[model samples]
Target chain A: MIERALKTGGVPIASMLKRGEVKILVVEDDKFLREILVGKLEKEGYTVFEASNWNVAQKHIQGDRPHVILLDIVLPGIDGFEVLSTLKRNRETSAIPIIIISNLGSREDVDRALRLGAKSFMIKAHHTPQEIVDAVKKTLEEYYLRR
Target chain B: MKLRVHGTLFAKFFWTLTALGTIPMAISTLFLYATYESRIRHIVDEDVARELQLNSGIQFLLIFLFVLIMATFAAYIISRNISRPLFVLTEVMKRIAGGNLNIQIRVRRQDEIGDLGNFVNEMVRRVKEARERQEEISAVKSEFISVAAHQLRTPLSIEKWAYNLLLDGDVGKVTPKQRELLEKAVMANESMIRLVHNLLDAARIEEGKFGYTFQKMDFVPFLKKLLQDRTVLLREKKINLVVQHPLPRDLFLTADEERLSIAIGNIVDNAIRYTASGGLVEISVDTAPPWVTVAVRDTGIGITKEDKDRLFTKFYRGSNVMHIATEGTGLGLFLAKNIVIAHGGEIWFRSRETEGTTFFIKLPLEFSPKSPSVVSHDSFVGSI
Candidate 1:
């Protein structure tokens, strides 16, 4: 039934990506993690691109308009907080939902990210790669349906 | 008949001095009274009036001396009893202040001072009990860490080997269903390994009694194995490493193989963390006669001067590193320092903010069989 609804147009269940493509950008400094996120999201049929730092993420956004971003709080140069804020401030990327996937999930960080237009914030230890993919898909679909 | 200290020679002497001063005046008054009475009797009437006046003067002197003696004895007894116990109590207070709460002051009387001593004893008992409770709480926390470390690794061991088995596809090519589950398991297991590592470190640090087994090992083959084993893990970041040589083909170093590997591994892991994708983490080895050293340099965000000083201390996270990443238990560097020190080596780092960081470890080339085992002894004392 979920597959049927998703294949039709869009599912109200906010889980339409199980059988569909949902483009995603994974911004993280941890290479090991970037590979896993890219692999898992790609397997789940989401178009996935990688960025090791804020500079590459900015570059990626200029070309491809991803539906959702998996942002790591700690990055190479500019941290994820700055990246999230910049993305939210831009008109073109403002509607593009973000989910902070990071080792920093302190209440203050989560609250800050949420205020900066992140759809959700998740701690890496608290969620698996697959869960992150699931969350991104759900949040994107929810944002779409709400809009 | 009782040999009384209260009415002893000193008390009598003090009283005599008082008596001597007052009695002379009393005698003169009496003499004047007698003369006045005799003159009055001669001038006007009576033997009776003179006799009565004389009797009153004698009685007054006798009563005054008696009261003076009694009061002097009472004052002596009062000062002795009150001051002696109070002085002893103050001395006991000093000892208690010096952390010797073990002394018991014997208060023979059931007076206020005895009650005070008992109250002090109760206070000491309570303080000692509170200290014991704190020690017990700390012990429980350490025990929990150790127990949790051991327990966590068991599940990890099971899941790790199980995933390996499943990924090997002995049960046949995995369906998407099976793949998804195994992927989650793998992810969770990795996190679990990190948690266990942190818990073990915390427990060991708290216990100050880390169990370590030392054995002489070859450095060359160990380094080779490390480089080979971590290639895939490092490939995730696409980071490259350059190994520079001043090392022999197969250098023999007398040290605990496991501990040395862990220490080097921590440094390598930290380098990997700091080096961005496409950045370099360089490993170089050099010798200074009796010493051999390994240096790891990363092109990641570096440490400030103040941060560099406190880098290897327990729970110390550098400002630059902290901004880049979180979830560090901050025990790896501390453990690495301990391991290196145990091998009679020195560990230090050089870093500049935004430039990058380089950590160097120096170990003695020759290990004396009599390496004192000083660390273990110190650890034992600390545990106590």
Candidate 2:
């Protein structure tokens, strides 16, 4: 279920792309998971940006901002929900789809993140980095059609 | 009327009692019709001739008898008037007792009794409204808790896994105290997670907002399959589970597998916990008429008679069981009983003080699965 939801939600369309390039951002607190996500995301033929916490995530959003964020619900300072909510609220980052990649897989949790405008929610243990990339790619593809 | 002999709520032949009792009165009235003015004078003759004639008292007795009958009829009408609203109020009380907080005692009359009924109705309404609000807040609180729990889980998992990764020398070796601290942290995090899950589950169940999908599955094979799945854990405990399956290999019955899993899981786990080393846990099936029974008998620290009475009660930690096990929250049996009752089933048990105990669950083969009735629990959500 997690993999499927992620696969459907992963894709991020870099707005300034030459109708080809896809840019993805991976935001997490743990250095290990961050490394794992970036390695696989980079291998998937897209530029990937990494942030250890919400501060760095904000920096990435402001400068060298990617099209979509693979945001973990847990971060060092401000959490991922706040970041996702801020992104959705801000006109500049609002269009960039947010996928909540976290281990919190409870139905209520999923419902909450989705209600907070998260494109989708996925539990980490069930998904590989490739699936997240696929999720981003798929989400971007779907959003491009809407655009 | 005549006193009722049985358990019936309403009585028949009430009108006949009135008619039977009215017969002589009717005859006397007929007699008076034949001699109208003279009979009227004779009936009240004692009132006209009191202390002057003793026989005149007989006519007076008749007049008084007529008035007594009239008063009895009038009393009936009055009692009926009082009973209608009283019945309505009783029905409202029944609804409240049955957990239907939304029912109101609608009394429009301004009499003292009516006012009392109206007051009670309004009180119930306010209570229902307030309870609905409390329920709403609890739901929102559950939602927030669920969300917060999920959000917090990611970091906690990362922290725990990272600590595990650290302690296991995936990254580097750690000191014994450091490892111990991480272990404590992991344990605490686990407890917190469980607490959140239980609290949310309880709130959802209470609010009647939870969804369940039921299907038919066999009992013995189901346990067998679950045992196979938990073989590793069972092996660690070194305790054997003997299931005497006289039931059909594919005994079809209607239920929600997951909920039943949780229910039976609690029983099995309780047995596993309570049974000392080398002790056996016996799970058996009894297919009797009117019910099917699944029993778990364990050679555990047997429960006291007091413990037996409140075993399935929420937050009740048995004295002996508590001494043996401290890690449990005492909510599993509570949840199990709740789910079982909801499934139109009965869960009960028998216990011996120091020998052994057996818990039994008898579920209907088929039942009218309780459709979630419109309740304060529903409006509880709506208001929020």
**Per-residue CA lDDT of candidate 1, range B1-384, in tens?**
664656544566556666766677678777877777666667755777667676777877787777577667765676566666676777766766766555565546787877886776677678768877987999999889777665555445445545754675744699899899998878678767786766666566567665455566788789878777779868988999888864576677888786688889989988988778889988988877698899999998888877767887777888767767665657889889988887889999888777788999999988664433322111111000
Cα RMSD, each candidate: 22.9, 10.4
Deviation in angstroms for A85 in model 2? Answer: 17
Q: Candidate 2, clashing residue pairs?
A: A9-A135, A10-A135, A10-A136, A10-A137, A11-A135, A11-A136, A11-A137, A11-A140, A12-A136
Task: Kindly report which residue stretches of model 1 are placed more than 4 angstroms away from their true locations once superposed.
Answer: A1-147, B1-136, B154-181, B304-310, B313-316, B319-328, B369-384
Interface RMSD in angstroms for candidate 2: 4.7
**Per-model i-RMS:** 9.8, 4.7
Give model 2's DockQ, 2 decimals.
0.14
Candidate 2 regions exceeding 4 Å error are: A1-103, A108-147, B1-76, B98-112, B129-148, B173-196, B218-220, B305-310, B375-384
Error of 2 at A41 (Å): 10
